[model samples]
Target: MENKTKKNAVVLLSGGLDSATCLAIAKSQGFDCYCLSLDYHQRHIAELHAAKNVANVMGAAAHKTANLDLSLFGGSALTDDAIAVPESETAGIPITYVPARNTIMLSLALAWAEVLKSQDIFIGVNALDYSGYPDCRGEYVKAFQAMANLATKSAVEGHAITIHAPLIDMTKAQIVTLGTELGVDYAMTVSCYQADSHGEACGLCDSCRLRREGFAAAGLADPTRYKKHV
Candidate 1:
């Protein structure tokens, strides 16, 4: 950590509850947060809008959105128009899992952290209640951190970049509770895999279901706007 009065960190803000909550946690820890969101051409741009709102409301020092075309590969429901966003949760890894999404996002974050000469990156990846995404696991985050340490000039110079996954072990309910305590506005986040242009959630997507359930478990009123979902 630098001897500056406040440490600087790059927070990956997805405009979802977890990421927003993660940003709040980082802020609470006294870090000057630089928020990053990715526009990988997902099914809707609503989440990007939510990310922007969260970053602004949280009073981030800066926010940057990087544009990428993950749909060029198009295997996942999010990136491919042909693949429908699954309304029901299926077993195993779901169709919504965009291949190498976190990997690419972290790589980009790592690049920016190096440019900023910061040694901290915060992501909101969780293993429990994570809707079967393999990359959200604890081991995956550790592996990425190890790779980042070996791959960056900062590491060689002894300023090791710490990839922080603050919500990795928390369940959705716990996440919601923590975020609420940190003053994260749930209504501003769009966690739905298929949110409408206005940022209204589909309610039936795995992400939405989990988010809804989280609020329920936390005994909080869900402020998410939803379309007429079956």
Candidate 2:
């Protein structure tokens, strides 16, 4: 059932709810998806495993994990053991923001996209119902898209890379509903910022709170696996 004429797309698959939905959307759009996940030594590294499973089940043409130690330059709680992931919401951009994470991930995806002759790159960064990560904004995505076009050799040769952020303006409930309609398995994705080794979520984190609320608001039973104590 593969469409030989379908264009290729590089998807930044973080193995989270949003990214998984993004992949399904890309597939639905008739693109041959190439999923890219990062192994950045995050506290919730279990999400990488979730990413692999999600990519496989979603029928990605290929999946790659680019290994890098982002913890070395860690200024955020996710990458540094010294900092604690705040269970409650904090003001003015929480400490969980990884410095230049989306930018770095996009650069890697762009490299593979250029090599694969793909003109599309998909990221599931949402502005609504999200932790206040500045990189998740629509304006940031637009700026990055402009920069990508100017920086890539492929773009200079008339092939422009389009950065897709399908969930940028959507509420979490809307996203969950759309993904469910697209046949995405929400349970297979992990959104916890500090998941355990078995991929069980700590329901107290900001990510978990949003996810839990999303399913509730959508009137769908949340299938996320949380720790027994949570």
Candidate 3:
């Protein structure tokens, strides 16, 4: 049964499959979802467009885009034009890992959550089948939650904040299955690290590979539109 009073939640939406699923999960838990997307000057601005579409389609109470020039720092491939995004699998954390990206995004989400008087913040950071980002790990989420509780005025006043990562331990296939069960339109979500202006995926990047494999494993047809290569 649904709760009579729906609690508000701030969801960090990236317009990707995982984040979309995360938002669906939050709504399922009876939270009034407020979707948050960041325009941090990444190569694929297409996902930001996807974010808006997803938020509307998923019935979010409100959606907001925060603009910032993370490209000014330019330490990673996504934000730096100098570094190239690798099409093939690479060892270690990969060049596509934005430095402290999840931390920064969560900080923004925390601020919004405090202002909205929402104690729950949901992020879609998966540890499995991901590009090996350090910030996506379980420990990182726990540490961030700890910091958020201590740093926020709401927490100090006995309204503790919780950071929810529903997909943290789930495999890509599992996430896909869950999202499908929740009626998420996978076609509207873009997981590509280098999507074209039209939001068509490259279908050769690490993110694309993972997404493809996930659908295959889930026995679901991939609905992603791919760009044609010469």
lDDT of 1 by residue, 4-56 (tens): 47888999999999999999899888899999999999999999999988899
Of 2 and 3, the candidate ahead on lDDT is 2
Winning candidate number (lDDT): 2
Residue-wise C-alpha lDDT for candidate 3, range 1-230, written one tens digit per residue: 46679999999999999999999999999999999999999997999999999999999999999998899999888999889889999999899999888999999999999999999999999999899999999999999999999999999999999999999999999999999999999999999988999999998889999999999999999999999551
Q: For model 1, where is the 10-residue window of minimal lDDT?
A: 1-10
TM-score of each: 0.97, 0.97, 0.98
lDDT (Cα) of model 2? 0.95
For each of the candidates, the C-alpha root-mean-square deviation to the true structure, in angstroms, is: 1.9, 1.7, 1.2
lDDT of 1 at 8: 89
Off by over 4 Å in 2: 1-4, 228-230
**Model 2 weakest lDDT span, ten residues long:** 1-10
TM-score of 3: 0.98
Task: Assess the local accuracy of residue 111 in candidate 3 as a C-alpha lDDT between 0 and 100.
Answer: 97
- Of 2 and 3, the candidate ranking higher by TM-score: 3
Model 3, total clashes: 0
